[model samples]
Target: MILDIYKDAFEYSAKNLVTLFVLGIFCLFSFLLIPIFLITGYNYRVINTAVHGVINGKDPLPDFDDLISMFIDGLKVVIVQIPYLLVPFVIFVIFGIISGQLTGILSNAIMIIGCLITLAAIIAACLMSQMGICHMAYNDGSFSKAFALSEIKEVIDEIGWSQCIATYLGLIIITLVISFVVTLIIAIIFAIFGVSGAALGADAGGIFGLGLVINSLVSMFIVGPYLSIFNSRSVGLLYTMQI
Candidate 1:
C-alpha cells in the first residue's frame, strides 16, 4: 500500500514536466505571496482529484489554468493550517518565558521537559494539520470542514492512528534522506569549486555569496516544488484509504 502511494505520487508528479517546471517557477517567486497560494491551491487540487479518482481523459495532475479559484482555495488551506501550528508555537513561547525566569537545576529540568512537550506538540500538530487539509479537500474545499475536529478524528479512527503516524513519519524520513543527500552533493560541488573556502579569502567573498545564491535557487526552484507535490499527492492518496 505504501509503495503504491509513493509510486502513484511519483508518476503523478512527473507526468507533466512543463507543469512541474511552472510550479517550481512559482515556488521561486513565492515571496510575492500569491505564488505560494497558487502552489497551495494546486496541492488542494491534487487532493481533490485523487479523492474523486481521475476521470477518463482528465489529467491526474491538475493544471495551473484557474489562478483566481486556486488563490482562494490556497487561502482556505493556509487558514486551516494556522491554528493547528499555533498550538505548538504557543507552547514553545510559554516554556521560553518560564525557563527565562528560573535558574539552576529546576530551570534546566523545566527547560528539558518543555522541549520534549513542545516536540510532541509539534508532531501532533503536523499529523492533525495533514488530516485537516485532506478533510478540506475531501469536502470540496470547505473551510469549515478542515476544522471539523470530530470528523477529522473520525477519519483518523477509520484509518487507524498507528497507520497514520507511520505514514507521516515515513514521509518525513524520506524527505530528510533526500534533503541530506542533496545538501551533501551541493556542499561537495561548492568545495571542489573553492566556494566553500571562499569565505577565508578577502577577495573571494563574492564567490561565497554566489554559491549561496545558487544553492538557494536550486532549493527553491527544484527540490521545493518536487517535494511539495510528492508529499501532497502521497497524502491525498493516503486519504483515499478512509473512503
Candidate 2:
C-alpha cells in the first residue's frame, strides 16, 4: 500500500524547486551517465535546506549565493572522500570532447562499445553511491561506514546477485514507463494545438530522449524519497522473511 506521506514528496519538491533547478544545472553539467549523480546530490542538499527552512517556517529560494555556498560545501565534503571529484568539474567537458574526437575516428559500433564500458562503470558507481548513502541515512551507519570495503561488500552480498540485477532492471522499466506516460500526455496536448509534437519536440521520439531526462528528474522529485527511505525497510522485511 502507498504511504500517506507520498503527497509530501511533491510539496517537498515544490518548496525547493529553485534548489532542485540549481542542482539540476550542476548535474546536467557533470555527466558520464546523464545527471543522475548531480540529481541525487542536489536532492540531499535540497532536503537538508528545505527541511531546515520549513522547520523554522520560512520561504526557500536557493539563488546564486545560496547555490554557490552549497556547491563549495559539497565540494569540501566530496574532496574529503573522493578527492578526484573536486579537481575541476571542467574535466568532464574536456574529457567528453576528447572522447568524441576519438569516437569520430572509430566506427559507430566500436565507439558505442567503448562508451558502453564507461557507461557501465558510471552506472555502477552512481548506484553504489546511492545505496551506500541510503544505508548511512536509514541504517544509521556512519558517513564513512560505507567506505569500509567489507561493510560495503556485505550490503552488496545481502542483495543476491540475481535479485540485485532484477532490481536494477526494474528501475530501468519504471523509469521508462514514467517517461513514456509523460511523453504521451504531453504529445497529445501539443497535437490538439495543431503543433506536431516533433516540431514542438514532444513527439514520441523527441520526447523519449527528453522524457528520460524529465522522468529522471520527476522520479527524483516524486519517487526517490520513498526509495531512499524504504530501501532498507524493504531489505529488512526480506531478511525477516528468510529467518
Best by lDDT: 1
lDDT string for model 1 (75-109, tens) is: 88888889999999999889888998999988888
Clashes of 1: 0
Task: In angstroms, give how far residue 231 of model 2 lies from its true place.
Answer: 9.5
Clashing pairs in 1: none
Off by over 4 Å in 2: 1-116, 139-141, 195-243
Separately for all candidates shown, the number of backbone clashes (residues 3 or more apart, or on different chains) is: 0, 0
- Estimate the TM-score for candidate 1: 0.84
User: Model 2, range 1-243, lDDT digits (tens) per residue?
Assistant: 112123333243455444545544555466653344434434444334332332223434334445444444344335333532322333444455566766455645555555665565554554455444444433343556435546545666765545544555554564466556765775465345434565666555655555456556754544444343223232222222111
User: Per-prediction TM-score, please?
Assistant: 0.84, 0.42
Q: lDDT for model 2, on a 0 to 1 scale?
A: 0.44
